[model samples]
Target: MAAASIFAVIIFVAMFLLIVLDKIERHIVTLGCGALTLIVVFGICMRSGKAILGTLAVGDFFKKDFWYQVTESESKGINWATIIFIAGMMIMVEGMAKAGFFRWLCMKIAYMVKCRTIPIFITFMIMSAVLSMFIDSITVIMFLAAVTIELAQLLKFNPVPMILSEIFCANLGGSATMCGDPPNIIVGTSLGFSFFDFLTNTGLIAGICLIVSVVFFYFVFRKEIVTENGAEVDMSKFPNPSEAITNKKDFITSSIIFGMAVILLVSHSATHLTVASIGLFIAVITLISAGKDALSLLKKVDYKTVLFFIGLFIVVGGLEETGILEYIAQFIESISHGNVMLMIAIILWISALASAFVDNIPFAATMVPVIQSLASTSGVDISTLAWALSIGTDIGGSATPIGASANVVGTSVAAKNGYPIGWGKYCAKLAPATIIVLAISTAYIFVRYL
Candidate 1:
């Protein structure tokens, strides 16, 4: 027990420092931490005369050993559904970009506002947030950030506020649906919570947070958005809307396929059509429409992110497999005195606060086993607690620069537009809003569910 606790703490500490340093790629950092964790925990157990190998399979421990070992380990641990969904979504995204769907959509929105910057800014926030509910937050952040930087150049306003709003709303919006955020996906699959179950349970809260988010943006950025920077931005100089809509048929097809994919993804718990299967089906049909490009789209997908997830899973899995999570769960349970509501609050608060500092994916992944143990020992129904964890960690991701992938991408987008958003300033803008929402969410879960 002592050995497991010490090793888990070291792994967590090392992972946090590496991420904050910004020098190491997150996947490498996580993978290294995972490997270190397995060695220390198991090495200690083996030295202590415990038959650790008897408990852990050769296939699970050795990643490069056998093909079936690697395959089975991944099949059991990795979220293939997410990987497939991301791959399929990338194809649709590529088609959209190639078809100029994003440019067309932006131009239409810009044209509708008649080049009014404030309204255009608000529209960007709403659209980014809405899209994040179905698509990945970081992808939406990248597109929105690129477009907003362009808009900043077009509108002659600082891109900082617009980028910040987009990032903020993206995090908040991703919390709306199970398929929206990585942490939410982890919660959904591990807890056996349906996609609809996530949306339904947290739907109202997320909606309320969305409304609050809009208001939060208005106050936070009102001065910046209304400021006259240099001169009027001539939208007429930007690319014409007509030129942006080159492939109307392809655009329509991609849109339809994406829409159907969203429906299928959300209906997964009922239909049992995993996101991976749906993605494969979509990828095949897309290939049939667009030729070999659709099949090749898999190469463009973010395998690194998937690898990061895999490593993080193994890292946390080692902790659980080594009994660290059980120790922490027992400690939490003792402190809570078997008070279910107190345990829920602690889980929500700890997960949220921890998420703000480190990557929420690993944070949430690590918490899964802890929460499960707490649930079993304390006699708590983890269904609502899982939702609480999802909401807090997903939204808490907005509180800091290193919190989520979307935050990092959004800030980078801001930098590209010559409007640098430093860690200090970005956190200052987001901390208050995140704290308020987290507090409300924490109270909401305890009061209603408890």
Candidate 2:
């Protein structure tokens, strides 16, 4: 490897290991790593006169050309579109939360399940997956986890498996839509793939996986659903599902904005707007129409996550600039030997295994460029490659509690509720199911796409 490439690899691996350890705040680690990448990796390249900024003379800072070059370089380092799209979705999902959207959904699902163990398990897991298709999976899990715990308490059964299944399903459902998961948001906005494109391709596969996964979980969890206290919940004690709405007017407004975001995503091809623009535009419209609560809604966005992505983008961009990703791409190509099916299979399984342990956002962000590089080198279909990676990252994320944001949120919720599911317990139960889902995804990709 070249000196810059080696340095890039060192910084990236160290960062990945730190992140996996979760010893420090993720944003802190990623931003620090990003700065290290620029100072070390890019600095080495700068010494060789191959860096993007070239020589930054004092006079050059005043010139428009120099500033333009700097702006272009920064653009390459951080995808503002992906960052903006994530912020927009965060605000939108926050708005929905303020409107009690998730609570309403949970109440409705709770009612329909009739307090039966089988129906409760099936309905909530399916709802978690289906809701995650559009809503943020973390938010979906928060409401679902809390509510499922209550249901479990009343029905006299353990809720740990239910929460795990929900986490798995939420991550799985996230794979089916462009805005469903953070990884999807990163990949979709970066690649210019529309919501419709995702739904037609990976979305089809996610739906199939949902059905099969539901069956797999049902069997595993059936024994746990046995009620030790009582087999029935007092459904009469629950409030009417409509009572979940805090404000009818705000509910309608938030729903319209959320729905409009999805519509704009689907029709972006005709509207000639970028996916990033569509998301941000809807977010802005939401705030403007939200009246005085706009600032509150804006404040609800997890800026910590935004900063994490920003830093992560810089770190990955450093790898791209220093040619580390290209090297990995070449290795993948050599392993696959120019076969598209082998490439797809390799990308899918590697991503799945890696994402099962790593945070999927950083993993997806890193792989995005690698996929592009592989596409160019091996002349493979970029869409197939992206879809395979998406499926891998999405479902594989649920194998461990720390793997994805939804899993993290779900576990935290479980912990807070006194149900504290350990990583060993979580993986022991969900990892095999994740493997099954991954196998199903690989076959689906091979049979359907190839």
Candidate 3:
């Protein structure tokens, strides 16, 4: 490897370690690493007088030449499309949240279940899965956790089992759609896979995983979810679900816009429109519909996360420029000996296991380029590898607490409600179930795709 490539690997590894440690805010670490990537690589190129951003000066920052030189490829750009799409989704979710859509939905589900312990447990898991298909899993789990805790307290059952089940299902279900999980968005957008592509390829497998997860978790938590014999389960204690809706007009408006955006995503191939346009359009429509409260709706967008993607993209772009991704792809090819099945299996299991312990978003971002390089090196089917990676990262995060954003949020919500679940307990209960689902997904991919 060259000196520049080695330095890029060092910076990339440092960024990964910092994120896992989480001592500093992740956005800060990624942004800093991204800046360092450009600076360090530019310095290396300057010393050698090369053209890896070596010729462009400060004045070219705003020129088309800069983007042409820097972001000339899908694997080597800031991916503003992903940023805009995510920001749009976030604002849409916030609009629905402000209108109390999630709360009403939760309360409605609770009412329909009518205090049956098993029904409540299964229904919430299904809800978690379904809701996460469109909205963020973390956001889905956030409101779901609050409602779940209240039901558990009222019913005299342990919330840990129910909460864990919900988190696991959310991760699995989030894999079914392009906007469901951040990694899916990153992969789908980067690879030019449309929404329907995700729905067809991963959605079917994810649905199977959801079923596997639901049954496995029910048996795992069967004893804990039982209510006391003397506990009074009264339906009168719960209020009307419709009462939770704060603004009827906003709820209706947001619902329509959210539906329209999803429809556009699903038809992206036929519409000939980029996902970015659809996302921004939805966001604007949502804000405009909010009337005088448009400014407040604007605040709903998570700028930190948007910025985080920017930094991560730049950092990954540096790796691509330094040719480290190509090196890794070559290494994988040598290891697999040109066997496509072996390559798929290796990527799937390794991705799943690695993602179980760390945040899958950055790992997925880093792997996108390597996977692209692998496609060029080995001539393997791109859809197969993309699905393998999508399932691995999407479902893998459910194995441990820190693996995904949804798990972290769900854990905090449970702990605050006095139903704390330790890391050992969480892994002991969920790791096996997660592995089972991963195994099933592996076989499906190997036979169907490979």
Candidate 4:
């Protein structure tokens, strides 16, 4: 049994390394490794004749407690609510995109900023952050990156810096709200943290980070952005913001549904409704309003992303089932001597660094229970640990192109448009800003919670 556990751990680590290296398709690696862990571990237990079935256990599957383990594993590993919420939001975002709402918004910003490079960059980054607070960061990146690329091409300016800045801001903005990022949604729902609570706690830090990031980008991209002959481009060539609206009816409908979703999400605590439920309800309403175009909207949802999440849940579930996460938690607690402040710092830094290499969603899911366990044993506030973990994971993903969903989407969009940013280039260009924001987050955590 011990050897089997070790072998499972080795396979899990190898799979994680493959994911971090991004040498293969992530969904394939995750699903394959997850299935292997379950099968191999269950077979080992059955062979050893160590099956312990409780009274409620049933049938051959339950003989070795395999079914029970799977049930428990899924309960901790997979967050169905978060998955459903993301899927619903993807549909809503698609509806809005098809309606030209995002394009209209982008055009409006471009018109407001005109040819002023600094103002244009700042406005776009701020908009990305603001939108990500309500919408998924990846969706925010998709629309924002496209508009930015077009704007950059029109003005004959480099779009890579602008796109990268928006990606970072989008992730930062997501940390401010419960519905902003998948990790935040998972942590909030698991710990019962309210939207307002996130606003007051993590929101403050995220806001500060947004401002700091804007200044950081300004300096980093100053040469590439600030054109000596700024007057060369004619603003008249730009499309009128009003003209960007292709379908007024669809725009209005999407707007109303989106607004209602926001209101419901904000008041989730008072109404006792989960954020996922609100998102799903709004998605349904949008579909009904779309009438015959409903199928088209549904088709726009990112099913691949949803599948990736499902695989991620099972992979992490295997770790929890094997007691590996508990072992990690114990190791951390022992090293920190159960000091709450040190533990907070450790979790923050470790999560930040780990999330920089791997996806934060699965990492957050794995850590939530571990953090909870540590908090319960150390007599620290779970809310505090949750906040630390949330901020860390949210900001850390900015360090690399593969770090977060927004980064991946933004980089891919840019690459498709003939501006391929390599991993080293992305890290060199964005790491400073990410590190600065991370430091600010750490300081804010100590000041606010400690």
- Put down candidate 3 lDDT per residue, 1-450, tens digits, no spaces: 377677778888999999889899889998998877777764654253343343222333354422222222243467666777889888888999999999888888888988778888999999999889888998899999998888888888888889999999999889999888988888987887778889998999999888888888888898888888846578888678899899998888877887898788787767666667777788888888888888998876778888888778877877877788888889989999999988988888888988999889888898888899899879997778889898999888888898889999999999998988889989998899888988999899987875
| Whole-model lDDT values for every prediction | 0.74, 0.81, 0.83, 0.80
lDDT of 1 by residue, 1-450 (tens): 576767777787788688778699988987888667667765664353232443223343243322111111122344445555666666666666667777677677877787677887788888877788887887788877887777666667777888888888888888888778888877765666667887887766778877787888888787787536546656668767767776888888877877887888777766666555666777767767777565556567677776777667656766766677888899999998888777877887788788888778878887777888877877788787788788878988888887888999998878766778898899888988898888878777877787
Please write out the lDDT profile of model 2 over residues 1-450, one tens digit for every residue.
377787778888888989888899989998998877767777655454345342112233344432122112112456666677778888888888888888888878778877777788899989998889888888899999988888776777889989999999999999999888877877775676767889998899998989999998988988888778544566787678898898898889888887787787777656666655766787888888788999988888889888887778878877888778888899999988888888998888888888888888889998988998898888888889999999988888888877788899999988998988898999998999898888888898889877
Winning model by lDDT: 3
Model 4 regions more than 4 Å off: 1-4, 21-24, 42-77
Q: State TM-scores per candidate.
A: 0.85, 0.90, 0.92, 0.88
After the best TM-score superposition of candidate 2, give how far the Cα of residue 282 lies from its true spot, in angstroms.
2.2
Q: List the residue pairs that clash in candidate 3.
A: none
Per-structure clash totals for the candidates: 0, 0, 0, 0
Give the TM-score comparing model 4 with the true structure, all chains together.
0.88
Error of 1 at 344 (Å): 2.7
RMSD of each: 5.1, 4.7, 3.7, 5.3
Looking at candidate 1, the ten consecutive residues that score lowest on lDDT are 65-74
Candidate 3: regions farther than 4 A off:
43-75, 230-232
